[model samples]
Target: SFRRSNVSPRFLHSNSTSHTWPFGAIAMLIDNAYDPDVSAKQFWIDKTVVKDQDCLTFMDNGYGLDLRTMHKMLSFGFSDKTTVKGVQPIGIYGNGFKSGSMRLGKDAIVFSKSKSTSCVGMLSQTYLEKIGAEQIIVPIVCFDQTKSDKHILDLMQ
Candidate 1:
């Protein structure tokens, strides 16, 4: 059975675009992560469990979750919502993060600003095992004001 859930934008992962899409922008963010000049920009690499596939996974941590959205959802959003559970197109509702992680990694790590985050959070191989899901979403870096302001982290107070 299939049901709809209104879980919006945990990450800013855009829906796939055929044309007029910025492959350039995606490349730039990846580039900036590795750039020597950008100190606020950090690179988290999971070198051990490569699986050697030609795929790159990027997660946006804190860009979309501003105060207004949080408050709106907090007020009236909770009362009228229904999240389903099953293996569907995205494969496993509501449990995507856990399901996906279980299917991917034996170990995981979450490279986040939060020091309390687990290594298992970022590494997908182990994550899949833990969550017992076919897919999972991990929020990686925060594209905050530093990236957009053009000031640079090394120069800030």
Candidate 2:
């Protein structure tokens, strides 16, 4: 037998409320990039217009997440961070991405490229609300970098 569990979209907003200030939410993302697993040497944040909507984009020169890792990151309460070379990871609870992204906007799309794989995932309150979704739904797509997939090329652009 199999069991199903659903998470409400409202939970995203509720979780984000833990951050008293917006800066705290942004700090969470920054800390994640600096964490041992990622060890990002550079991170960039920029404002851009996408599909007529203003958006903020974040990019990092870290070890990017694979498909499974990206899924876990978007889900609730799953963290695999470990201390490396005496540097302890700051995100231990695995709720930071949800709290931080939801605090900043109604939607977030993550595009990550590891050495062998590339993936895209979305956590979108706007999409959920628009579709009248009763439970949160995350869509993720993965691409093998070795293949010449048009989807991968499109994502890169």
- Which candidate achieves the best TM-score against the true structure? 2
Error of 2 at 128 (Å): 0.7
Full-model lDDT, candidate 1: 0.31
Q: Per-residue lDDT tens digits of candidate 2, residues 1-157? A: 7868778898889999999898898998999899999999999999999899989888899999887788898899899999999999999998999999999888999999877888899999998899888888888888889776624432311
- What's the distance in Å from true for residue 38, model 1? 11
Clashes of 1: 28
Residue 105 of model 2: what lDDT?
87
For model 2, the stretches where C-alpha displacement exceeds 4 angstroms are: 1-5, 149-157
lDDT of 1 by residue, 64-132 (tens): 222222222222122221232431222112222322332332333333332222111233433434555
lDDT of each: 0.31, 0.87
